[model samples]
Target: MEEEPCSLVYRLEQKYLNDDDAYMDQDIVLTNFTGSSPCKMASKRALELVVLNNANISHLGDVSQVSGLMQHVAEADLAWNSIRWECVKSVLKHLPQLRTLNLSYNPLDGEIAVDLPSAPLLHTLILNGTNLSLTSLSSILKNTPCLQELHLSDNKLDFSDDDESVMNESVKTIHMNRCRIEDWAQVVRLMRRFPNRKTVFLCENPIKSIVHQTPVEDLSTLQSLNLGKVELIFQEFSQKKLIQIYNIIDFLDRSFNDTTLEAQVNH
Candidate 1:
């Protein structure tokens, strides 16, 4: 029989029994400590809310250490780290109860493809500043059916003609600002497909023009349309085209102000 470390023993005792218990009722725990020791200790206790903010944690430690702790965790923010896709997948496997995941500012590159073992209860997934491609995006959407809000702003999402079907009806809001998306027809197709989408951010894209010839049937579902800085280049204009854009804008304005649209979906 060997005695456990002083810190581990103390943490175990406090986790099981303590008034205003640190481990049991802990909402957030942020530390900059790196290496396996701190992670191993932190993963031992059950926490409903946790924040490993600004940590140097890069790799996946022992998976068994973080098994049951996921059910109790509601929110976890591991932003501004050096974690990659493999580490992210390992961490996500334990977080069955996670609702919000912020992986912004990580040094992740190449395609972003992940297949979770179970459907994540995740609603918001922030991938800002990660090098993600259309293939990665498709993979994520195909796997995470419950994902609502996705942030891919400031990444390289160059969409070809073949990637049109990736933007389906499941996603609510998508931020693709500064991604240099030049195809307006593809954008129109996406909007038409996802009539129930809440917001579509297309800022800073080289969109020459938006020829909205098709009559929009369900504009009541669209909330925000960020086309700022898009070069709307119209070659041959028609009366129908002008009216269509105007109608779309009007619907967007109404949807943005109306709170009912937000209540329509439970993501």
Candidate 2:
């Protein structure tokens, strides 16, 4: 069992944070706060990290019903619940200091293009398993300009059209594993647009086969690219009876480079 946070020992508000300082008033957890609104308690205590996840809450208005814990909150885990985009925007109104939000595992497929709250402090957003598209995604990016890390894995993402992802330079890491994207041009567009993208996860996407064919001319900023599962990709081709294995050697030879490539050079 987890040690019940060693009781809040009232220490004089001092400059140096030592072992004597109690961790009690630091976090307010109500994962099982089933029939009660915990934000009132959070507001009363001015908690820093509020975890209301798995609380069977339909809308974030439950928190708005009771006031208080808005100014001090830095992290919120509202994942694994029935939350919509509007509810999240309402959450931003109270949690301006919020940096990380976990909205994963929720079926928020209907919400689209809802205006984001003005929270410059917000940096990370976890939207895993949410059926997202270009239109809904653009709406979110339009509202939040300072997002640095975005997670949109396990969704149906197809950027075959000429739609450009409205991602800011602040965003450096993108996780899109198993998104089913088949367009290499869309992937190239993302790489060209984001000047600071250090890590990109495109594994298990349909666009893997085209990587060898597509000239990655604009991926100078990319440091880590997870395009593994070569066996799976080849097996997928075999299962579909699309191409013969004899072309595999040709594919490898064309993608290999004898000289170190410049960031701007064509592959």
Candidate 3:
């Protein structure tokens, strides 16, 4: 006979609320949890990170469960769950101090329209592999007034020619890796949309050749840009005009090397 599945409340208590060793760690991670029961962990104000990834959770059945436990959570990872856009709004309502939220791989494609609650403190939001649309992206920008970093990688984003420009002043970094962006002009439009963007990753897109042919003026003011698999044609541009782009490429190279070195050192 198979052993019984642990309740979410019991698992949380065993790992965080009751464990003496976990007292120093202010994280509550319950991945692959199938229990439908509400997490009744007594309010733990000290907790900062709450990860419920791949839990098959559609919604927080009890709002009190969220309010009492995740009120002060700074980062929440609810990735690979069955959560909708409305549920995200509810989570934001309770998690007032949430600085980073990972809602990647959630089934949000069915949401025709949504109005997210104001998340003034939210800075980073990951929506990778969520099958998002421009309409949903617009709603996200409207609510996350102070958002600085956005991850929309692995999604099929089809921006039409007639779409009006969407601007958000606070957004400084964006990750659009593997987004299948085919047009160089579309890339320029994206940059314009996020006027204050300092860092942008458009890796694995089909606009590599177009990037080299585009005017340098179209790509100025960017501090860091990752064009993965997009090689630069150094012979086509003058050294003075290409210096900024060269610096960005050098930065990406150095960042990769540093990360590799750190991993090697740890190993």
lDDT of 1 by residue, 94-148 (tens): 6777778888877776665555454457788888877766666566556566788
State the weakest 10-residue window (summed lDDT) of model 3.
Answer: 258-267
Q: lDDT of all predictions, in order shown? A: 0.59, 0.58, 0.66
Q: Which candidate number maximizes lDDT?
A: 3
**Candidate 3 Cα misplacement greater than 4 A, ranges:** 1-26, 29-44, 208-220, 231-267
lDDT per residue for candidate 3 within 121-215, as digits (tens), equals 99999999998787777777788889999999999887774565765778988999888777666777777778677788887665522334445
Task: Write down the TM-score of every candidate.
Answer: 0.63, 0.67, 0.70
Sort order, lDDT high to low:
3, 1, 2
Candidate 2 to truth, TM? 0.67
**For model 1, what is the alpha-carbon lDDT of residue 32?**
37
Q: Considering lDDT, which of the candidate structures 1 and 3 is the better prediction for this target?
A: 3
Better of 2 and 3 by lDDT: 3
Residue by residue across 71-171, what tens digits does model 2's lDDT show? Answer: 56677776666677767677777677888887887767875646676778778988888786656766676656788888888988655557554456777
Kindly indicate the candidate among 1 and 2 with the higher lDDT: 1
